[model samples]
Target: MDLHIVDLIESLNNFDENPSARLSNSIIISDYPGLISYLIQNLSGINIKILRQLLEYIPEQILEEILINETLPSKLIEHIKTQPPDYDSIKILSDIYDESIYEQLVDSEVLSKLVYSIQGAGPKMCENLVKVLVFISKHKMQEILSIPNSRNFGEILIYRLNRAQGIEKKLMLKTVTDIIFSFPDYFYINDLKVVCDIVVDSLSNQEEEILTENYEALTALMDVKDFFDLKYRFSEIYEVLQVPEGNSYILKIQDRIYSMISN
Candidate 1:
């Protein structure tokens, strides 16, 4: 083990033992400028708890500088492809606010790997991966949309949404809505119909948060008028909307859908 890593481990252990020592230990750890790069390089071997602590304590500006200067995003993507995907490392990467990191990820074609990973990921891991994709889509929609089989990625999200429950389902619904809003023209007709179906089915959900997300998703889908024809599912949507009576927002969404169909 490298001396710096050994020292970092010791510092983390001390911090863990005496939570009050956090400030001083964090300062000591931050002095080692290459710490972030070294951690990324040895992500597979490092303890996830230690990694999370180091990342959390490191100042954002310093972390950003190290990430940009070290070209760590490329290395992280390489690790994802070549090794067992490290959820903690990927989670760390996802939490980063740097646009350059995401740009490199997209340039290196990381989206496909991420989308593929979702199929096998555990629920928490799946949510983290989807959150990363949501971040990338927000920053680089055109690049993500330009990738081959991008629509397939959207379909996978819809598939996940159908099976997901609780917070996982809500996140997927929000992700789908954001994607539709960002690139409404990118989805194929079949995928758009499936998304609409998901939204319509979700209308009967009693959870206010889920219902709000479903409304936003439906609104986004309405933008893709060329592909999404609400008429086919009007009866289903109307029936579902009836289950949630007296809610003004749901009532408004119901009214909007009715107007769209009538026009």
Candidate 2:
């Protein structure tokens, strides 16, 4: 037992559960190969309470790193499914987007049902669906739509979009749009134009940091032109941004948007 390893465990300060105790038991495991197997044997009680307890003690950053670095054990995952996940707990999980953890969670017959179990979850469920949808394979698209949850997901997405800005915000909106298209039934489908207009208007007010990164995304939303108006707006934007001479990718896209639909 290295003294520094002991220190890290002791530094945890207020840990008071079996899972916390078990995780503490692994203080030296990171340095020792095969010790996790032994530690797993010692940890007979890895229930949701225990797992959440571990989540509480570990910094979310470290938990994210661990989830990415290792395979989530099936037993541990099944436990996460048994209890309704705490909102904060789910928030933590959603922050880290590891492909493998996604695979494991989607495989849970229990979680698979719960992912779309929007009735009880309400607004929170919509956010959860958006988070999970990013990692969904194409085959699962139908199953996701079948969840019967109302389009509360759209509101959750809009909420996040309102908060995010620049490239970060643009990527989030693009992800939402992708999810929206995949589960188009969740929304009126016709309502996409409103969403597009909202996003474009947002870009209209933003600093160039966002416009440079999101010009194309905003313009592509024009593909569904029945509801959105882009020609005048894109023209105004191109003139304001000065089109950068022959390298005007934004201008070209705007031109394409114009050709796609007239007034």
Best by lDDT: 1
RMSD of each: 6.8, 6.4
Error (Å) of candidate 2 at residue 241 is 7.8
lDDT of each: 0.65, 0.49
What TM-score against the true fold does each predicted structure earn?
0.57, 0.59
Off by more than 4 A, model 2: 1-65, 68-76, 108-114, 117-129, 137-142, 166-168, 179-186, 189-194, 207-213, 225-249, 260-262
lDDT of 1 by residue, 151-178 (tens): 5556656667778788768877887788
Overlapping backbone residue pairs in candidate 1 total: 0
Off by over 4 Å in 1: 1-41, 44-128, 226-230, 242-252
